[model samples]
Target: MTNVLQVIPARQGRAVRLQAGQAIRIVNTHGTQVVDTWCFNAADMGEFMSMEHLHATLGSIFPVRGEPLFTNRRRPILILEEDTSPGRHDTVIAACDVHRYALLGCRDYHDNCTDNLHAALRQIGLRSDECPSPLNLWMNIPVAPDGRITWGEPLSKPGDAVVLRAVMDCVVAMSACPQDMIPINGADCRPVEAHYEVLT
Candidate 1:
C-alpha cells in the first residue's frame, strides 16, 4: 500500500524541514500537476542544490530504477526505488511570476512554483530561501540536442507516483503547481500531497 500526507500551502505557505537521510515521497495526487522541488545541505544552506550538476555527475538525465537522488554536496536525499512512468519531466525550467505573467500576457489563471519558493523562504528565515531552480517531478519538459524544449503530455497517470529514500538531514521546498500560464499544469493550479516513512 502507498502512504500519503497532504500539504496545503494556502497561497503563501513554505519551508519544510526533513530529518537527515529519511525517505520522503512527494505525491501528485492529481494528474497534470506540476511541482517545483529543491533540497539544501541541512547544516550549510549556502551549499544549496544543483539539479544539472547532479545529473551530470551521475551521467544520466533521469533517475534509474532503485537509485537514490542526492544534493550537490554529494549527500543522499531522495532515492527513486520506483517510477510509475518515464514522464518527460524538466530539470531546467525555472518557476514563473506575476511580472512574467504580464510578460506572457494576461492568462486565465496564475499560480507559479516561484511563489511557492518565496513562501518556503519566508518560512525558513530568508537566508536559505535562495530561488534555486527546481526539478519538475511529473510535468514533462522534453529537451532536444538542438537546445530546444517543449512541455508535452504528462507521462504519469492519476495514481502514478515516485518513491524516494532520503539519505541525509535536509530541508525540502516544494510548490504544488499553481501554473496556469503553461502546459505543465494543464492550465489548472492543482494541489499535491507528501508522505514519509521510516525505513528499517
Candidate 2:
C-alpha cells in the first residue's frame, strides 16, 4: 500500500507504529500548529521518550536535526533525521492539560495535548499509565540569559517538516495542540491540523 499522508485533526491526535529503520515525517501543514510528540518502545511502554533525559543528552533545550531523541533509560529511541524548519522545537515546557487551561481562566473543560495523547494511544488499542513530556514540535519558548523563558510564536512556515527515524520498534503519538488561550500555536492562538506519513 502507498504511504498516505495522515491527518492529525485540529485539536486532536493520532498514533502510529513503526519498525526500526522506519521514519515518520510530520508536517506543519498550516504553520500555526504545535504538535506534542511522544515515542514509546513497542516492547515496553514504560520506556518512552523523555524530555528531561533528552535535554540532558542533547545538552540543550532545543533539539537539533540529526540528533537522537533519548528515552528515560538514556537509550536512543528515535533520531531526528531531517528538519525543514529553523529548528526551534521546544523541550522545556510540559504538554498542556486541563489544569493548565483552568489556570488560564478556562472554566469549562478544554481540549488539551495531554488528553489528546492518551486518546490517540487508545485508538490504536494501546494504553499508557502516564503522559511523558513531549517534544513540542514547532512550539517556540525563548529562554533569557537570567533563566526566564517566554512563550513565542513558532518561526516555522507552512509545509515545514521533520523526519524522525526509529532506532527501535516504537510507537509515535502526536497531538495537534489546542492552545487557543495562548499564542504558542501562532500569534492568533488558533490551532490547526497537521499531517504525517510513515516511511519504510
Consecutive 10-residue window with the lowest summed lDDT within model 1: 191-200
**Candidate 2 residue spans exceeding 4 A from truth:** none
Please give, for residues 1-200, the per-residue lDDT of candidate 2 as tens digits. Answer: 33999999999999999999999999999987999999999999999999999888889888888899999999999999999999999988899999999999999999999999999999999999999999999998999999998989999999999999999999999999999977999998899999999999
For model 1, residues 1-200, the per-residue Cα lDDT tens digits are 33345464433334566665455565555556666777776778866557767687667766666765666666556666666756455667776666677787865556666776876767777545456767677778788899788866566666566655556666767776665556666544434443333332
RMSD of 2: 0.9
Error of 2 at 135 (Å): 0.1
All models: lDDT?
Answer: 0.63, 0.95
